[model samples]
Target chain A: MNHIFSFFVLGGIIAAAINGKIDVVTTAAMTAAGSAVQRAIALIGIVGLWMGIARVAEKSGLIDKLSHLIAPLFSWLFPSIPKNHPALGCILMNLSANILGFGNAATPFGLKAMQELQKLNNDPDTASEAMCTFLAINTSSVTLIPTTLIALRASAGSKNPSEIVGTVLFATTCSTITAIISDMIIRNLYRRRKYN
Target chain B: MTSEMLGESFSWFIPGLIFIVFLYGHIKGVRIFEVFIEGAQEGFIMAVKLIPYLIGIYISVGIFRESGAVDILVKLLSPILKVIKAPTDALLLSIIRSLSGPAALSMTMEIFDTHGPDSFIGRLASTMLGSSDTTFYIIAVYFGSVGIRKTRYSVLLGLLADFASFVASVYIVRKVFL
Candidate 1:
């Protein structure tokens, strides 16, 4: 079913390209791949560094202490996940990676979070509310530095490559806020419908 | 080395410091090799999963470019560009650039070489490419790899964000730098 939708979108794009829109599409694809490769390489290093740090932190008990410190805040944000759940730890690790703009690094943590979420779910077919909420937040993840953007800007020869930092911060914050609010609203509406 | 050269040498110092830190961590019982291999294995698996979507995205991009649809859309949106006080050339260039970075960069470089990098058009193209995302590629690759069947509002939001960045890049570059 979804394959059809994908086919249509692909067909539309191809049709456009054939009709002389190829220049734009071709350029976008090439650039995206180029940027993705460069970003991925940089991300591997960054993630490696962070993961090493995180591992050390865990070994030294800092992660536990830090998790304890941030437990209240995390609990407030994710009331769905029990405080002691392993998913909470995964979520924190994922969030930390995301905050640092290490999406490559965050990917494992995100998967781990999902795995943990799956364990807590009684129904294997339907996604849990926690899963939905996590997906919502992860999809609209807020990034402070936007390292990839900075790298792109620098490569594009921006004199002040980091100037967009403030704007990105504002935009991501708005997106995250919107995601959370919408998730809550939809969940509430669904609950109401089910009850009524 | 000269004093100035010595001062410039410190640029290498930070990376050296990082290497030492990594080594120290490795020696202190961190199984860096095993973890890295594990991560790489996962990444490879993800890359395999993403191939289909990536192909779809590439094909779509190919069709979009060939269909004359973008040109029509560009023409239709020209009036809106004027209202925003952005140069029509820059606006079009940005849209194209966002879709393809290297092509955009090459275009920017061409414009820069011909008109100079200090030109508004060159700066605008560079800025736009820098700030905005390759929306279709992101949707197809990232979301697809994760097996997100329904994108819901993500596609709309991503495109909207791209547009916002496109406009803002022009505004900032023109108003502040240019």
Candidate 2:
């Protein structure tokens, strides 16, 4: 994060100087925090709504049902994990929420799942194979609906805003499959070697 | 049914999910209302905690955009993108989407404005935007919260997924929409 942060700031400065876009740089820097705050504020309502629903989902035992539904698939994917582990439930909830396009709702569950997985980690500093796999899958999660994309397309005046849904689903599924496969390969490849 | 057809009824999906949960909780003898409030509170607090990180990343991303660094990167990567037959217009969106959501949205809007929404480039951009998460920002938030400094191969594999999504987006768009 630090390295990437510095690269953005320093690279931006150099590029702005070369491109003579100093005004844009100054303006953007000035409003950056304000814009970010606005975004966070906008997020509050959505987060609250989804988190509430997610909580209800948890209490309702839907999460358990979801875990059971995906248990076979989870077992195959996360062979290192035991069947009834808390991480398995959390992972199932997170992935289900993600598929529903409930990103805000998925995040807390994802964080909780990570914390649960961390409890099983032998090394505290390095991410475990399960963590890496989970992260990869979460990063490219398949969604049943691409709501934001549809909204964007609609606002842009597309006659068929949902036209790309099939493509998005297909593409995300491919990426998810690739993420899982590569994660497994990388995990095994680096298993014998110690990463410090 | 195709997802597009499902999209037409997407409005009910969330409410249906919530109703089902509420019903289940009631049947299971859980305090649905109280639990919902508790989760909502946590969500609010989480949003508050995210402010600093969000501001920091957004500022950096804004600076990156204003400075034209992304433009330079896109120009440099365009040859490779061309070799893969990705629309040149989507180069920035695919690159930035994994870094920052808002930045990628801006790029998507730019593409939509220039290419028109129904155009092949516009649809490709939209599909790519939908398919991937902001990997770096997610890693920073999730791992930083856990105090894990050594990320191992998470970043590499995450980028691999993003790469796969980008390639798949291009191919699928060509096959389905073109």
Candidate 3:
């Protein structure tokens, strides 16, 4: 994978150089680098702020209360996850972050959830049902506020930038439903394969 | 005037809500400050881990855009986009949308500035921004952090979802709203 990625980069640079677009390539690369830095800064700032809030929530038992409040919903969505597991907490945090449109922020929690799930798997070769379900949910998680999108819109200079709120809600809801349905179908297939 | 309009629109309400949530969470004994510090510290580490991959992705996107590859691809696909009744500008916009929200916003702003916000292109860009994901970064960081070696299906599925949202946004906005 690293080799392939390196090849792509090298090939792209060589191609650009041959085509006499090296300057353009360089500029584009610089712009991209600058943009990445900006994105990192924005994400770090936002995620840090939220993490603090989430910490407070955790310390205050709000996260626990939230877990309980949303447990039923989570159970329905992720039946494969054992009740009262550490993965459950991580999954909840991941979901909450997604809901807030903080994909960057949701990432570590999602990774932690996966790590916890990995520890529970008895077989090293195959992923457990819970892990698969969690991945699907995380990938297709619904986003409500889309803070990043709003920020982008604001930066882009859109008038009434928040106008896409309704559309985002509808689209993400659809994606989430699609993801859930697909996950169920796949899981069922895997179960039949294992048992039959 | 625009800022005033935005303020009048109660735009601050969401940020306020975020603040309230944070406060509530803190009050619940989360030790928000400490946890936040810990998380930020983690983020710093994550950023360092990502340096190599970030360099790769940024360079690739840069090359694509700079070598006129993006433009060539966009031009080639423009007719197809038109046939599908999607906006040409949005195809490129969506690609950049997730990589950098601010850049995407500025691009959208430029479109809106050049062509009035009510224009088809402007509306399409707006809708695209709302609907898409930042695919590469999400895959790189989240999947990388988890040490998931194979992302064969997830990446494909994510991009597909992004495509669906992009196409659907145009269709819904044009057919139903506009």
Q: Who wins the TM-score comparison?
A: 2
- When candidate 2 is compared with the true two-chain complex, its DockQ is 0.64
lDDT of 1 by residue, B88-150 (tens): 667666556535444555666666566544467655655564445455554454455556555
Give the least accurate 10-residue stretch of model 2 chain A, judged by summed lDDT.
Answer: A46-55
Which candidate, 1 or 3, would have the higher DockQ against the true structure? 3
TM-score value, chain A, candidate 1? 0.71
Write one digit per residue (lDDT tens) for candidate 3, span B58-141. 767566645755455577778768777776678888766645445577787788778856567866776676666566556565
Q: What is candidate 2's TM-score against the reference?
A: 0.86
Model 1 accuracy (lDDT, Cα):
0.57
| Candidate with best DockQ | 2
Classified by CAPRI criteria, candidate 2 counts as medium
- Give the per-residue lDDT digits (tens) of candidate 3, residues A29-53: 7877876676566655655554454
Instruction: State the TM-score of the second chain for every model.
Output: 0.79, 0.80, 0.73
DockQ of 1: 0.17
- Best-matching candidate per lDDT: 2
| Per-residue lDDT of model 1, residues A132-191, tens digit only | 666666655556555555555556565665665655555456555665677677777778
Model 3's lDDT to the true fold?
0.63
Candidate 1 CAPRI category: incorrect
Ranking by lDDT: 2, 3, 1
